[model samples]
Target: MNEDVSDGWAASAVAWIVEQGEDGDYGRRFVLDAPMRARIEGRGFRNALDVGCGEGRFCRIMQRAGIRTTGLDPTEALLARARELDPTGNYRLGRAETMELSAEFDLVVSYLSLIDVPDLGAAIARMVAALRPGGTLLIANLTSFSTAGQPDGWTRDGEGIPRFSIDHYMEERAIWVSWRGIRIQNWHRPLGTYMTLLLDHGLQLRLFVEPEPAGGDPERNAVHRRVPYFHIMEWQKPA
Candidate 1:
């Protein structure tokens, strides 16, 4: 695990979330989307591992749906809140890449948290390892890269290099970068990149869902409609 990078990023991101209150912007919109419910149904997974689980929101959702869930995160504060959310549920403090648990889960999930990691490949590899043979790996996140031959519609100001802003790269990838007082870098991976990564890890792609923008600030919804902001992917580790 790249402790410094992962820990620093998790701490800062978790702090931002905590400051927003438990039901802040991210907690309300991103976490409560319908796709999460659909993934559990579509994949037929009863046991789950939530990588980068924050505040245990998703875990609780899974629990309600009858999927036994274990939430894992790098930030202690986040795990603390997760415990508060479900005292009987399991919560662990650890980096996704180094998560070592004896149990093999039927579903391994990473919410929007993967974007903050330093090495996404390593993180995915670990999740794959934790999955039971023939288990499902479901991921939902923002696409920061381009797709097919379409051009990216966003751009950024060089002055705010690592800061979150809209930026378009040559590969038609669109990235939304945002920044607070510290730890200033936010990037989403495109659909193509995500597929390639799954193939590289020998995971079979079963379903890919590009969710249409639902409800939020209308202005924000209009903006997300153009970019691949929300997606859910289900892959299987061949039985």
Candidate 2:
């Protein structure tokens, strides 16, 4: 992850989450929310990949849902925590846009980490390639360029990693950040944009999730109700 654009919180943030076991406080809050989980579980995917998976929380969830799952992330700390969480879980340390996998997945999904990658098109294209014909690609991210805020900016650190306060929000749906020297980026095409990309890549749109209001857990929900800001996109590769 680029340190300059992400405020130097990319890997440590995941570490904090793994240490705390809390969801939203760290980076996991944006993508792994309950409603999104419901959408993924409802799909009934048999084989799946979790791109930019941090500490493998979503991977564990996928396993419990009976989906055979693997996780991919670039950060060593996050991968270590993920391994600790699920020793048997399959995980690889690599960039999301350039992963190497032999098996095509029934579903390829990403949570909040897309905003940190550097090459959105290459990443999406690679993911599309990793899907089986008629398989699904599920992504969640900040929906609009204007809707989300940008990080501060970039500067070099002692470790030579560019450090910055930047968060990628793109006009054309491509967003990325360079932090402390590491560069991570993602794309956030609107619903139509995703449809077009899917079509161009030989995938078909299946579902699009708009932002929704969050309700209290009643039992003991701690998350304060707020206007939802993320989009959940589901697309399928044609057989």
Candidate 3:
């Protein structure tokens, strides 16, 4: 992780906590939570690790499902808040690139957090290393299309129809974004970059899905359907 990325989250930690109340934003509540939980349900996972687990929400979810989970993040403020909320839960202060664990977890998850990682190759290596054989690595990330439309996410034409534009799709760089007082630098990489890294690391792809919003405000859902924002992937290490 870049120093600026860590600092950005530290500064915006409070705003992020407030933005993600008990449930999460539209994406998590409607598009991700159900499917992610479904994938973990009855899988007999003994323990899990949540990388970039901001505020420990998913960690708590795993705990409720009887999976021992450890939440790892670089931001101390977020980890502190997570500990405050779930006093007994395990929360570790560390970056994914430098995570010091080996074959220790049945499942490792990256929930909409991969974008913030600057050295994603290193981070992915560490995440794969942390997983036990046959373990699953679940990831939810913003689509490259969505990230490509960084500074100007969405615009409206004369007809008042929303339009998403993309350029330099193959370029890998950092873009600063802010919303609801939560500012951060998010790294953007082409879809192939992520796929190649996971495959090169010897992870077998189990599932690849671009999940649409299931149910939400009709207007918002319509917009999301037009330009799907997120996708989820399930990869397994050889046993």
The TM-score leader among the candidates is 3
TM-score of 3: 0.96
For candidate 2, the C-alpha RMSD (Å) to the true structure equals 8.2
**Which regions of candidate 2 fall more than 4 Å away from where they truly are?**
1-11, 14-32, 145-148, 152-195, 217-227
Q: State in Å the error of residue 123, model 3.
A: 0.2
Candidate 2's displacement at residue 193, Å, is 5.3
Q: On a 0 to 100 scale, what is the lDDT of residue 107 in model 2?
A: 88
Every model's TM-score: 0.76, 0.71, 0.96
Number of clashing residue pairs, candidate 2: 31
Candidate 1, after superposition: displacement of residue 16 in Å?
Answer: 3.1
Q: Positional deviation of 200 in candidate 2, in angstroms?
A: 1.3
For candidate 1, give the lDDT of residue 66.
Answer: 85
- Per-residue lDDT of 134-192 in model 2, one digit per residue for the tens? 88888877655323333333356889964433234335444454443334454444445
Specify the highest-lDDT model's number.
3
* Candidate with more favorable, higher lDDT: 1 or 2: 1
Give the root-mean-square deviation of each candidate in angstroms. 5.5, 8.2, 1.4
What tens-digit string does per-residue lDDT give for candidate 1 at 1-239? Answer: 54435335554655556554555454246433676777786446788999988788778878878889989987776677778768999998888767776548988988877765656678887888899888988887755542221233354557743223443433432233344533423444555665777799899988877776556677666555555555678889988
Model 3 lDDT tens row, 193-231: 999999999999999999988888998988889889999
